[model samples]
Target: MTDPVHIVCPHCEAVNRLARERLNDTPVCGKCAKELFVGAPIDVNTARFNKHIERNDIPVLVDFWAEWCGPCKMMAPAYLQAARRLEPRVRLLKVDTEHLQDLAARYNIRSIPTLALFRNGREVARQPGAMDVNGIVSWVDALMRHA
Candidate 1:
């Protein structure tokens, strides 16, 4: 078995300790008993976003977006497709800038469709703009390799 990793529950926002080997086995949360990785971009408010970014051992890809932004809406489907390919390797998150402006300002998100990659509670790389599924996948893959 590998080391235990801290994985914040996507359902209840409770942090769970999980073995690295079992991350792909459809593990359920210890507190809420809900599936941990649901294979989609989780819509996170401030509290959940903080917990996720700080607690998760795996890398987190956050799409900082707003409902009123055209590029953000245009990239929504691509983000979802990227989500399917990313997890349970990465945690894909959608943060609405309009709802959580503090998070937006904290992350220095000047653009609507900014994609920030975080690991161990620190940002590694950020890309601004809308990218298709393949482009997103390739960008993440390159970053992951370098990281």
Candidate 2:
């Protein structure tokens, strides 16, 4: 069997240890007893963002956006659909740049609708723009394959 991996619960911010293979089996958090993944992006502020990025053994994909951004709004549904496909393997998240300006500045996110991929608590890839579900899936798939 593969090693157990750490997964941060989306519901209650609890950290759970789960077998790597069981990630596809709909695991629940040990603390909150809630399903760890719900097939959608989790909206996080700076504090919660750090916990997920640093504690999750899986990779994370973050959409840095603002409420006023038209492109960000247009891409929201596509991002949610992409999350449905990418979850359990990757933790998908959305951070509002307007509210969490520190996170945006920390990541040097000069544009809204930017996508950042993080692995082992560090950013590994970034894309700036809006994309369809297929494009989002393809981009993440290619990167994860190479990684």
TM-score of each: 0.96, 0.99
**Candidate 2, TM-score vs. the true structure?**
0.99
Model 1, runs deviating above 4 Å: none
Per-residue alpha-carbon lDDT of model 2 for 1-147, expressed as tens digits? 999899999999999998899999999989989899999999998889999999999999999999999999999999999999998899999999999999999999998899999999999999999999999999999999999
TM-score of 1: 0.96
**lDDT top scorer:** 2
Candidate 2 lDDT at 79 equals: 99
Query: Per-residue CA lDDT of candidate 1, range 3-92, in tens?
Result: 999888898888888889998899999988999998899999898898899999999999999999999999999999998898888999
Worst 10 residues of 1 by lDDT: 6-15
lDDT of 2: 0.96
Clashing pairs in 1: none
